[model samples]
Target: MKSWRTMSICLLTLFLTILMGCSFSQESGEATGSSIILEFSEIETITDAGVQLAYDDVHEVKKIDNSFMVYKKTASDSHLYLGSVRDKQLTEYGFVGEETYIQDFTKNEESLFGRPMTLITGICGANCVENYLFEQVDGQPQLILKLSGHVLVADLNEDGEKEVVMMQGSPQIEIHVYKRIGDQIMKVNLNEEIGLTNSVTYNSQTNVFEMIINNETKQYRYDTDSDSLISL
Candidate 1:
């Protein structure tokens, strides 16, 4: 009985020490930040050229500090996937024209029913562009990228370019907008959720953008300058 009790205490002390050591190391290592990489076998190569091209396009956009909203094509039994990479790395992932499952590393969470994905360019702020997954109304999944409000306006300045935006959460607040000129995307913020029925059209003047809620007649105005509503 005495020997067993001594052994138990020894084991407990060792275990506690290990746990403390791990915690300390992780806290210090966080200062270095983390990097995400897609692993491929050395002898393996991309088989689908189309998929490869799509990935390449997304990758280029990301390199310029842009975000993407991509969806997987699950409609009619078709499989499509899209992703964005920056500097030969997987920065943002998405699906094009469909719905997809998006994994979030920051939150370590996954959700369903994301919106249709789009590629957001010219978003200017550092760490402005974000990535996400989309799930369409037809029960499909996709990926999405986003840019912050500051980044959007700064990038799209002095150009007659439509802004692209990125937002967070299920409802998608705080958007960042972007546009492409030649090869680079000019970005801006299209903030303040446009309120309306279901769908609406945006004219260049008077109202630069428009929105509609789910099947309603109420139209709303979006202001890009201060990230607020101009009218509703």
Candidate 2:
């Protein structure tokens, strides 16, 4: 009878040990899955040269973050450079491109692919502008998507995700819609051209996208399940 009692106690001890081991492993796995969140500072123009400039003839110095900066030249034929701040000086690390007449530099209020994005607007031609959407990957800015002409960024379907709507044309105004799906910004085919004369905007009061085409107002609602726009 004593032998049986001893054996039962041994089995109970072994079971408790296994249970504690599994609990420790589950907690460790949760810690490994955690990630770091990046925060960006307000967009500030570089007025003083306290921080050394990247270019001798700089048109503008746009501070994207505490570490990352953008420098543009003063000439008509100029390029944009992704820079870094160190020891009160700006150093060029990534070359954006030439003939990039930067008009606006700002951060998107909406997150893309569960991450923040930066939007850079540049002149493509007369009465034309291109929107360059960039995401930070491995500590470097990477262009994920580009939209031309009159563009609007909004949560069209109110699905907690924003979509890009662009009114493009000179010959004829055609509205184009783009969404970020699985790390790719794909054009959502409306299957028909929605012409616009003035501009496109998201009416938060009504929760719909509206535009004035041919001096008349038209509205559209984004269908999340169908992945298309519904005319209203």
Candidate 3:
């Protein structure tokens, strides 16, 4: 009886240890699986020498956690950049080494520039004061794309289910894709980029996508498979 009890206790401990190890592995995989590389152009109201007010549009790359890299130019006309240090440790998660890294700038700072800084970014361009998608109006997610924009309701991946594509939502001049989940309309940020043309058309015969964005740039396409944009 004593031997049987000891064996049972040992088995239980081993089983619990295996379960904990598997749980940790699953959590780590989730973080690695859906990690995205966010890239976009951001506008900053840069004040330069002689009291010059200029909007410097800089490209940026970052992670989902908001850690990022900003590109800049200085007075010496030399190239400059900023990013996290790889040799240093990350303060957020306390994981050894920084998950995010920055590259050092090689240019001299222009004294006249009012502290080259970031002014955050919008979904569209500077012309779009606010992105309706990011804002919650009247308790609903903003569906604000350009009023005269056309949406693509074609199947982009050749899959049975079609995807919704919209023209330049913001900083990047890439085609925007979207999927519908119930009543809300969501922007599919990252996907296979097909360039930044204002229009995209499908060819049933050739089975190729065509660019027809020259005229009537305001028109938006609705997905025929789900018809979510209209209801969106």
Candidate 4:
């Protein structure tokens, strides 16, 4: 019994140490005020040739910075591209399958992975709704997470960084939250007892996220230090 208890204690201590290490790394990154632009290099200006020109074909274009733009195409399907109007070149980034449409785009004031972060939503393949969190990772645009169902992107914890909240499964009651810490993106734990309703709303004034069903309403606030959600 003594031997088993000692082993269990050791394991618990090791686990706590690893978890604290991760938290320290994330806090360190935030403290330094990292820039997202450091993760990406300026696209090489290419001569007019075989490069697909998405600049003209896109339905809407949003500037990432002075050098790059995100273009959205809406038709029977929706597609998104990371392209340059000056270089006349573009690269398809997210939502490519069957019958997709871009639903919304939001920009985070703070950088994620040393590059500007974008939250995008779309419907793909037989009216399936999909949400994507994107940022430049190692000189390339990368999708941090792509999930199906209703989605929202906001700074849930009032931290400088925004979190991705997505609702999956039928009746849209299942809720999942994703937070970006340092170089990693993780899914945070949420209270399952407080079910979500048809409408999930955020009040910028209070910086609170709320879910309402029938007459019952639940509110949550993000705990930045712990990287978790707390009920308000």
Measured by TM-score, the strongest candidate is 2
Question: How far out, in Å, is residue 145 in model 1?
Answer: 0.7
lDDT of 3 by residue, 111-138 (tens): 1111221212222222332111122245
Write one digit per residue (lDDT tens) for candidate 4, span 1-232: 9999999999999999999999997754432222111121122232322245556577544565554455557643245554434555565544432323333433344354344766555555444565545666765545555566666656665556655666566534455666656665656323242332365555556866576534567565666665433556
lDDT of each: 0.34, 0.57, 0.33, 0.52
Q: Which segments of candidate 3 are over 4 A away from where they belong?
A: 33-129, 132-178, 187-232
Candidates sorted by lDDT, descending order? 2, 4, 1, 3
Q: Which candidate is the best by lDDT?
A: 2
Deviation from native of the Cα of residue 110 in model 3, angstroms:
40
Error of 4 at 48 (Å): 32
Native-structure RMSD, model 1: 20.3
At residue 33, what lDDT does model 3 achieve? 26
Model 4 gets an lDDT of 0.52
Give the 10-residue window scoring lowest on summed lDDT in candidate 2. Answer: 31-40
Q: Which runs of model 2 end up more than 4 angstroms from their true locations?
A: 1-109, 124-126, 189-219
lDDT of 2 by residue, 1-232 (tens): 9999999999999999999999996654331222111121222233322344644445545666665666665545466655556565565444444454444544444475456887666554565665656677797555566565666776767778776767677654555667766655567423143322444555555767565544666666777665545667
